[model samples]
Target: MEVRHKQATIDKLTHENATLKRLKFAAGREHFNAEQRRLLEDTLDADLQAVAWWC
Candidate 1:
């Protein structure tokens, strides 16, 4: 990927990862049901992979 595109992907994935982390771990907001949490976990894994590629 081009540098600019890669950077953009990384930024997006980083933001997603942070959001997921908050949703998964934040106090008083652990509203994810079991299935929803599972999906978020999967998405977080993908986000980590995407950010790792750019890094």
Candidate 2:
């Protein structure tokens, strides 16, 4: 039981780390001006919030 719990935790952390890395890579893929960056960030925030709400 203890080993199973540890493995589950590891899996969750690994998934979250991968998600963050992907988000970072996507955000860095393009260069934006300050205004565009703010808009992009706002859009990402809204999308993330929607995802969290669903989760």
What tens digits encode model 1's per-residue C-alpha lDDT throughout 1-55?
5988877986897798678668757847556678987897898888778677766
Could you tell me how far off, in angstroms, the CA of residue 46 lies in candidate 2 after the best superposition?
Answer: 15
In angstroms, the error of model 1 at 28 is: 1.7
TM-score of 1: 0.59
Each candidate structure's count of clashing pairs: 0, 0
lDDT of 2 at 17: 61
Q: Find the candidate with the highest lDDT and give its number.
A: 1
Look at candidate 2 and tell me the lDDT of residue 7.
75
lDDT tens digits, residue span 13-32, model 2: 56656755776797668566
Off by over 4 Å in 1: 1-6
